[model samples]
Target: MEYIGSRVINASRATIANILADIRRLPEWNPAILSVTAIDPRVLVGKPYSIRAKLPGSPTIIYEQVSTDYVVWHLDGLQAHETGAWKLVSLADQKTEVTHTITHSGAIFRMLAGAFRTVPGLRLDRLQRRAEFGQERAGREN
Candidate 1:
């Protein structure tokens, strides 16, 4: 199954891309992520990282692609295979339109598709708040 979400953030495309590419900061922007561990601060392609999330189990996540405009990562855990991609489009007035796409295939995800459908949108909302305001302000707003 695939789920997609987008938001217009009042930040540069580079800023949004940098935020997404920084693996150590996942918990700051992604509401589902409770913590990240044993990972480099800078996300490198093909490097695997672990994240503890609100979900039932921790997932091993690997970045397949990373760039200033986009990033793609894959997650394996809970008997599921999932891929996530983030694309940034620069807009006027130093703004960026960020599109986040998630695709997962497995018996577990198939059964829990409805429950996980809103994950991308929620993450994007937090990301927008984080990118626009500082982390401290974003936390208070949330």
Candidate 2:
């Protein structure tokens, strides 16, 4: 099964992508992510990061930035056949459009894909508020 989502945030592509791609800051914006530990603490292509996230039977994540516009990764111990992608597009006036896509072949994941589809959207919502307004809006949210 595949789940995809998109959102527009009022920030430069570099700023938004920088934050999203940085493993160290992931848990700061994404609640599901409990922690992220990358060997180099940088998002290089084909880097495997140890992520302690709130997912099923997974504490490590394999990360790879396929391109400046796309990223692919899979939850370790979840299923080799399952993977996810993030697409970032720069828009005019300091705005960026981000699209998230996840493909899970597991039977349990496929059955729950509908509910999981909203996870990215919710993550993006928090990201948008933070990236656009920073702590002022984010502080209020918390």
Residue pairs in clash, model 2: none
Worst 10-residue lDDT window for candidate 2 reads 74-83
lDDT of 1 by residue, 104-136 (tens): 887788878777789889989888877888653
What CA RMSD would candidate 1 show?
Answer: 3.8
C-alpha local distance difference test of each model: 0.81, 0.69
lDDT of candidate model 1 versus the reference:
0.81
> What C-alpha lDDT does candidate 2 achieve relative to the native structure?
0.69
lDDT of 2 by residue, 1-142 (tens): 6777898877766666666666777787777679777655557666667777655665566676655477677665463245767787888867778888777676556556576777778777877876888853355469
- Which regions of candidate 2 are displaced past 4 Å? 79-82, 135-142
> In lDDT terms, which candidate is top?
1
Clashes of 2: 0
